[model samples]
Target: MKKYFLLVLLLAGSHVMVAQTKKNGVYTPDNGNGTFTNPLMWGDWPDPDIIRVDDYFYFVSTSMHYVPGSPVARSKDLVNWEMLSYAVPRYDEDPRYDMKGGNAYLKGSWANTIRYNNGTFYVGFCTPNTSRTEPGHFSICTAKDPKGPWKRTIFKEYMYDPGLFFDDDGKVYVAHGQERLFITELNADALSVKTPQKEVYNNPAFPYLEGSHMYKVNGKYYMMGSTGGTTGRQICLRSDNIYGPYEAKEVINDDHTYPGNGLHQGGMVQLKNGSWWFIIMQDRGPIGRVPNLEPVTWVDGWPMLGDKGKGVETFKKPDVGKTHPNVVPATSDEFNTAKLGLQWQWNHNPDDQKWSLTERKGYMRLKAGKAAKLSEARNTLTQRVQGPFSAGTVEIDVTGLKDGNVAGFGVFQFPYAFVAVQQKSGQKSIIMVNADSTVTTIPFKGNKLWIKASVTHIGYTASFDYSTDGKNFQKIGNMLNMALGLDWTANRFALFNYSTTADGVSGYADFNWFKLKDSL
Candidate 1:
């Protein structure tokens, strides 16, 4: 009895320790006394566009191929931010509903969500549909509120990663498309181009790069963006005029001591003190594409990033700006709320009625649809992988079992991925590991059970385990490399589920919190 009691005590103690740990997610704004870290918004907040509206600051980012598109956020000091909502709701409304857009474009919306003239919010976006024997198109949207009863205006196709800049002279020009900086004039309502369009800056040619933000500061126009790619490096450039003579200057890139990546995407905001700072996105390759904060300086009106001496990184708020303290939210969720959180997104366009909560059921029911293959399912729900250099376990309780049905969690690295857990067959369930639709069964006792998958980037292993009680885990197989996802390589670690049956799995998954831990 003493031994058993001791075991209970040990278990209780471990749970407490887990609760006390720093709940991992994005790093919030520091109090200005200390330096901040990279990935300010960790998982997949790509092509960020931010605006300083008085004392309050609002930001938005692209959520490509991930549903519930156009992530909206608000912050006071430009540090900590709360997710607002999908800038544009309902994927079916998207012109490209079926895989017609392909994985290249199905990714939720990308870039520029901000309020434009006359009390309406505007967002310039890119739709890179690779499936079609065509390039891509750019569109603009308008909303009364940031939370949005948003509407999109169809226009002639132009560029990707489009950014709308309203100059002081009352002229609205769009600096757009990826690979190069293309520009065109938009009507006063900020919709389509009225003037002949021109490629103001070609990024691939010399220096103008990705995630370009064109701003007017002190009567001078500055264009800062990610030059290389989020992983390789980044740089900022500026010009005295908006039209021409734009020069590229190095910001943060291969020159830094902590030069971890070259490609970067995000926005730059000026503080009340008139100092400059930047937040950019980067792909850790393993963690998925995430955000990072870097302090920048304007020497001779040119932004200097990283360490001028060694060109590395920073935590100090920097003399350039004042610091503000704030908190976003804890990541690990208990699923006790009625509304789904923004941290989660669907694979592509989704069906609204397909997923539901009856309140009394206390679980989300995803009915099977015409989606026999993941490629067919319009909505393959996925959430950003929220970890960095860490070890974590995904625990889920599934009640339904079907041959064509699958529900579990695994690290998502894209095109080639795996789901290591139970597959439902009406009422019976079996433990199995799914990689790229291929299943390897690890026979279990019943249909109702708990599944735990532990991921280790160290050994490049993703193991499957099951437990009646959340302890004494039994390994199902050797490590699974996540890079082998379904269609393309995923940028972040994510949790996903899909069922292709006629009735779908007539059950629910009790998705518990992920006990997140980092590898020191």
Candidate 2:
């Protein structure tokens, strides 16, 4: 009887120590009790690659078709992250990157690798061919600082899921491809491949193996990659040689319980205290792919994640000397500075003449150039939409808008929806372009209006409302089914202004602020 009572007490205590950490209507890793949760980042930051440099932890992720691409984030504690820089800032190699001749939607850098060698930080990624005729390109960007004035070098060959590794012998090599991983030597400058590529490992068990990141730990070369696609699993391969007779194992999965949640496509890092953690991404529906930090333990020369090779939802925080305040990626923008907030990203390469912060002090003035379709609008600014229950509010001043101009706030994705104020022949009215091909228009007499978009549930349903008085907002459009589009990306909170004419005319709108609120 006493043994049974003691066992019950011990189980209850273990449950208390292993509670999940969450915050603000979303999953937050930092628990404030020296423990954190599964998803270190709540929003869509897919295919994360993390590296520790001195006291700072630098993170890189895939930015497929967004400008200022290959996002780099810095963190003191791995749980709290801030936007740092973009490895590929301009995407200048392709004209489609600027949305000129064609659109590079759903095609940009994928599964970038971030490495710190000697004194420089290197980010390498491959841009896949959007079409069969156009070939893909691989590029490496290097910088002294993670937040950088990075210099990009585009190579001719395409290396899918490229992993940059600097061996102890001072040799640079890249591990790339799927089904069979290949290793090729690079020149000292890492500008281009020098040697013929060799097939190192062929995973017969895991067929679609990619997202490979090379790491040398304790004189052993480790190649970590994800397989099984969207409903995937993370695997780790270890070898004594850089080019190896490698042995592989699946390190972590969803524990085979979380429906549709795949634990795959992320990088691992060792903390200053010699503790290891893996930050991998999971497909979380319309909110897109989010990141989760799993505790890793090295057992018998292998890194093990979660409980007995299963991903954990909560765990003890890394012993990084101190705790960090819970932080997610930046969202709200006040438009108070000459430079735009790190949260805002242009849909494509922006037209320099079409957008300005200095023209109207303390406002983002987006000049609507002659673009008849919303997809062609050049200066549309956007930020990711947080999951569960989150709202985006923007204040727009329409006093400077030209005739045949439409200025509004929207959910930017395939099959998107928006509520906007359109001005034609000096007459202004509110119009809604809803998801279901329905258009609702109402006469408007106001010069300034506050627009709000609220996403509810599992990031699928969204509704738009507008207010002339900023306090009383009325619903303006039908609810948007905010699913992950055919493009396979998250819906974004978009603010845009564009002209309907193709006569080289321009109209503009001034945005005072963009505020975000996440329900607790």
Candidate 3:
């Protein structure tokens, strides 16, 4: 009896270990031991900027053209993170943001900077000039808390890839520009420029130098930036004066984690335990630019990243004094809440009258908006597709859809695709739209349907499936070979409803729930 009991206990322990290693049926970086893996969160969290406020670490990332732009997250141990809020509530700078005469696909917010000073937090980013009518500008947001009722100030000047810095004497300055770097002092208010821009460091060796993150450590000023675009390397500059004759070095130029794509363009933060870590991004094809957390060691005066400048795949977690529960960004949503989940973001600015979570009680109602193509559709909700493999499934009610309406779920990118239910001339049919504008149709008469998009990072492919009953799903479309277009973003899972015609009473589709898993 004693021998049998020992065997049962051993088997139970093995099961618990396996369960702890995964979150929501997805492989997490946290190994449940003391070590963790790279690509920290396993998604397209690009242009990351991290700051340590007391015992907590606050993170912000670039969210171009996505309403509720610039996502923010908080972590206690740096390995475990939770989605806190967004710094920019919406893009109110131009009419294009609303998809009025045009669209802002890759031109909203880019390369953001986050810093904390004297009980106030600041996030700064730039919007590029899209056309003659829509000019580019810089915007700064301030709040006491990261999860904020943030106050925003827009400036006419376009400061590309800004790095907000606070000097020892309480002077504030912004380091910005593309290949040619410049530093401008901010007024006491830290809202507008107080001094004219000065050329700080512009070396021909480091071309395409941008994403500046300025820091002052031990009386020496350091400006960290990335060169070589997406396939780039991290460059660091050291100077006695904030502006001037600086020494430049290639701090990190490695792509061991994801070969051929070097880690670059992110900021560093000092933990409460007095250790430093660099949060940089690695471009992983169509899935998007994912962030990697690397250890930082100060050699002489320069902060070297990774294991002697090579990328480390697995390393001991930063000793934040204690272990925290494993957590990943929330993905699955039941549409039971008054508002959409933090993971969800509109492709551009959404039409206020088009989408609602309260109208159907437990469903998210998306009214059809007129659009020539899915790329131009408004109120199209999206979230990042996870790495390795992930499947996003949604239960949608097509009964509410009207004629000329199309509603379904699929991968959203430059060359996107979806498996949707199309209603035309009072007839309904299930159709699969490929990335190359090819469509395959099959007649369908169903009120409720479950649609899914399965994405795999290995081959960078996305395929679609659908089901009348929730338990079983049938494959629909040919495999989509995803590619990174001019959007400068990873492919995302999107839910959309739009009208092909500009007439009649446009209807809506109700999404009951969105569930994510490793596979079907």
Candidate 4:
């Protein structure tokens, strides 16, 4: 009878633990009450542009060099968001996007703008010129639905950091450029330029002014942008005309939330309840720039961000007429579906024929691609590394690995490190490749293994471990110092299978599943 009573208590305790786990994710912005935290998301969601279409809010962010570029997300309360679609499904602008002879690392998309007009959705972004023969062009993708079948139009002119706006007069204009702002009128279709670019506002006071978001409020034209790059402040310009004789003010310049990294470079939206809110980005070191939600107060006909121009650490949720369940972007993947989860993207353009989910049911089969290093390897699947702390674990079957093939998981950036299983000269071994190009190896005859990477924002460090039995993991490498290098992107978790030899394409790696947790 005592044992029966103890079993009941154990079952009750297990249920409570499961409930708690769901309530608090690895890094949820929702505090689970009436209030929430500053960063709406604790991951690399930089250069955010938001818009409101009736009751729903839509957002788009930069996805440079990653296939399915410019991720778009949707939210009801502007706090909990879900991945909707990618603005650019693939890059056909240049051969470099496919890593053919060269690679487009930091040149694909930047500061994308999303707008809804007359039952149509438009997404605009610019790609920098990769070569003399392949010039960069401004792209406008239009869709009847935000989730898309988007049709794209590429313009000859490259408009840096474009802000697409539709005026009441049934005309279109694009506000673009850096330091010196320019305005260019577009044709009614908004796919071609109607006029040559003309400088509108150029002030030395606003150094490095970019990321333009144009809007009209209360019969006044407002141009919102950021200055001083990553450690910058948000600025707003007001004028009576779209082509402005404008007056500027520094709206937000706070670093209390993330000291030395100010909140800047994002758009704002007005809720149905008549409350204004600013969704901005904060440079949070190696984990990448994170998005923050700040309240906007109008003073003297000017929009002031946060509490009197300061960032708020905690505040009441936006009154979207109702409360919303705490939700976040999906992280764990079972690989049981025919299509890859929206959370995953390729490092660059993937060779579709090399990777398959149908070839091996209940698993993702990544055929080996010939590459000397991970950066040049095709079909390297990647996803954002969640912060302030998170761990990613994966189970892989290495039985099909051939000589010169290396398949495993690691965090990817300019400087990347991973714990992979390498088969060389008929010998299979576990190896740790550090950011500095040093390697550590140990013999392992196991056909299946589990690898894990744990990241902590406190020290901005990542450590790797591997296990043959999945339950017991042993450390493999020294702590990797996650650095913000040339990529202009936050470090991402990458899954890759590449080979050093020419005949390695015949080998493959099968990934069973990927799991993520708040702790190691």
Which is the leading candidate under lDDT?
4
Q: lDDT of all the models against the reference? A: 0.57, 0.81, 0.85, 0.86
- What is the C-alpha lDDT profile of model 1 across 1-520, one tens digit per residue? 0110011111212331111122343334343335544446544566677877667677887766566667778776655678876766655544555455444344446565454566767776776656467565676767778777778775666566676788777789877655567677877777777886676666564443666777787888877666655444565557777776677766666422223455466677777777776766655444455555666777887777645622323356544344455466445555556777666666666666666545434454554444454444554555555443344455555554345566655555444344434454534344354445555565555434455555433333455566656676666544666553423234344444556665554534545555444433
RMSD of candidates 1 onward, in order: 6.8, 5.8, 5.4, 6.0
What C-alpha lDDT, on a 0 to 100 scale, does residue 17 get in candidate 2?
30
TM-score of 2: 0.93
Can you tell me which runs of candidate 2 are displaced by over 4 Å?
A: 1-28, 255-258, 436-438, 457-459
lDDT measured at residue 108 in model 1 versus the true structure, 0 to 100: 45
Angstrom error at residue 325, model 2: 4.1
lDDT string for model 2 (445-464, tens) is 98999999997544277888
Mark the 10 consecutive residues where model 3 has the least summed lDDT: 1-10
lDDT (C-alpha) at residue 33 in model 4: 73
Which regions of candidate 4 are displaced past 4 Å? 1-24, 130-135
142 Cα displacement, candidate 4 (Å): 1.2
Candidate 1: 10-residue stretch with minimal lDDT = 1-10
